[model samples]
Target: MRKEPLLLLILIALILAPSVQGAKKVVYVAKVEGTITEYTADQFQRYIDIAERNNAEALIIELNTPGGLGDAMMRIVSEIQNSSVPVIIYVYPRGAIAASAGTYIAMGSHLIAMAPATSIGACEPILGYSQNGSIVRAPEKIRNFYTAYMRSLAEESGRNTTAAVKFVTEDLSLTPEEALKAHVIEVVADDVPDLLRKANGMRTKLPVKGKGYVVLDFTDVQVRHIGNSISDVLISYLSNPAIAYILLNVGILGLIFGFLTPGWHVPETVGAILLVLGVVGLGYFGYNTAGVILIILAMIFFIAEALTPTFGLFTVAGVASFIMGSLLLFGKGGGSIYLINRETFSMLRIAIIVLAVLLGLFFLFGMTAVVRARRRKPETGKEEMIGAVGKVVEDLDPEGVVKVRGELWKAVSKTGEIIRVGETVKVTGMRGLTLIVEKAEGDAEWQE
Candidate 1:
């Protein structure tokens, strides 16, 4: 009977042990370094979904940025504010700064922490961009709007609204220690481990609206780190304005060159693929269906022109494609890329178009050179050497001499055939100072 009781106890203990170990808390960590783009926002949302689904104790975003697209930053902030799992924004790795748009994201989190020596703020909106380390403030209207927006975000998160407003209005900056003292950040941690230890048992508001505040216990948490994926890296790269601009130009030029030439369509094939990629890259900024269809038509025309050699037949079509692609890519018509103000976008558009025109003109000269070469006749003796007939002046045991173009030159027989002096041979090709020749099929009169 005693043995039966002991065995029952052991069975119960075994059953409960697994559950106890499995119940350990989870904390999901995502690192963000560089400009906050749409890809970054999307990836952050994905992390939030994973953390919420897994019932994580908290989702920590380790941030280090010099600021990026304002619209992307807003989307990320919105995601954080709406996430069910508590979101903590940590300005990590000493010397990192959450400046400009970064401040807004940091403020939106349920809890904000910073590493020693890190700073945050300096979010003044600029006009166009500060070229060569210069600051050009946006107009008064833009400044007022951002100032109010910053104030509201800080107020909602229970931070110093005055300081936050200064971040936008006066471009105020604060170090980690200063931010902690000003109640802008909850903790000043040296690293992730230190952050967890400092934040353990701390009370933080639930990110979801109307859910109220909850206490976060980071004790013995299982930290799962999520890194950027391959797709995210590609999207981020394509979203770059300069790269997309160069790709579009080069792709268009490749197609034009391929169409002009009559041989193997290597350029045309490469051009078509690049043009499509350029279009997709522009899609990151924003695009419409009509413009996209026109671009596709342009590509079809490119291939058609390649199949049938027509000089400048697709010029109008190619130009149309470039114009439409440029407009859709840079214009603030439907969606947003950076949420940059109208003025800044206008400047960018003009600069890109000017540079593109110069590049096109430069390549136009090259195309003209190719046309000149093709139009020149090959009827002259010097131009007609490759297919001309020659006479073997010296006996060929295989390597001998031949006379062609009114001059004797070193020659090699194609198949090592023996030929006596005075035999006629054909000049197949020229290799440096020597001629590659094969025996003439007919006893035709040689032009020696």
Candidate 2:
């Protein structure tokens, strides 16, 4: 009887041990709704940290993005691939997509799910600009390398290799149902609750840091949302092509205006901040170094115009350089990597050229007028005595007072002439506010 009781106790303990030891299931849902940026990386890492701290069962990322920088995308993929918890990428809430770098990220996850009407695919490599307003596409070899990389990622996830290949080779796209049928994705869920329910009891493989691989079976999953914060949303908006373009323009104009007026702290501050942000965006987007250099040169030209008289040469050069630089700023990354469109470029170029031409003409005209005015005879002050006919206000043997411009001034005769106070005289030169006078026409009392 005692041995039978011990066996039954052991059997009950074994049955309860699994329930006690199994990890509590909690799902973290992180949403990516716009352009992927460095900030996005930070947000993802933050959520992962939260999930790990809470010992969450898995993380579900609902991605809807047009695309973003390659480096950022790669970093995100690396994070997801190396995560301790299983990550599920879902194109959810309907009308969402996983395009460009989004596709890479989705494929990097442990599982990929899409909502009805959602789609994913389209991987293409884009290049930076050159110096002279030209767009250059990446070499075929490099493009093929990326294509192969994407293909490998897809294959690793057990997604359709053919469809993934078409994404890069032909830019193919498929709806959520089609993606499921094509093996590009696992399931379709209409919303987060449905997604969590479907994801429950799913087996996942996660690569531990030191260990090779660990199998995790999710049970009793509970969904927790990780939505974007206000700051993250703002950063996402600023990273957009249109917003970035506007910021760049405003920054450049602010800096220019500040330089012209000097001591305008607001514009200068705003300009500096925006310029730094714009540069960060440019670096993130892989703008051409040559084009960036050209922009720097254009700024130099404009500065030179403001500080020195360049006869409009610098202004003209600056305008031309700005147009060319802006044109070449973003290369032929197709729709994939382009920060600014062709129409935007054309508009910016025309606007800059027109503004520069007008400013240059104004500077030229104002400078010419100043030069001409200086060359003309002085109309007032000590300068007015030059070649002026005046009268000796006092007896001037060699030095005395003379009247010029209704004012009396110390006078000296350059021709060694003496004159009475009432005598008329002429001013030939000046020295320290002293007029060098000579006898007018026929003044017999004063002679050389």
Point to the candidate with the largest TM-score.
1
lDDT of 2 by residue, 165-281 (tens): 888777788888888889888778988777766766655433544333544444566667887788776676566544554566568767877877787578878987888777765
RMSD of 1: 8.6
Across residues 366-428, which tens digit of lDDT does each residue of candidate 1 receive? 445556767787765534777778899898778899997688889999888887798889888
**Candidate 2 lDDT score at position 75:** 90
Lowest summed lDDT window (length 10), candidate 1? 331-340
**lDDT leader:** 1
TM-score of each: 0.69, 0.68
Task: Count clashing pairs, candidate 2.
Answer: 0
Model 1's lDDT to the true fold?
Answer: 0.76
Deviation in Å, model 2, residue 441 alpha carbon:
20
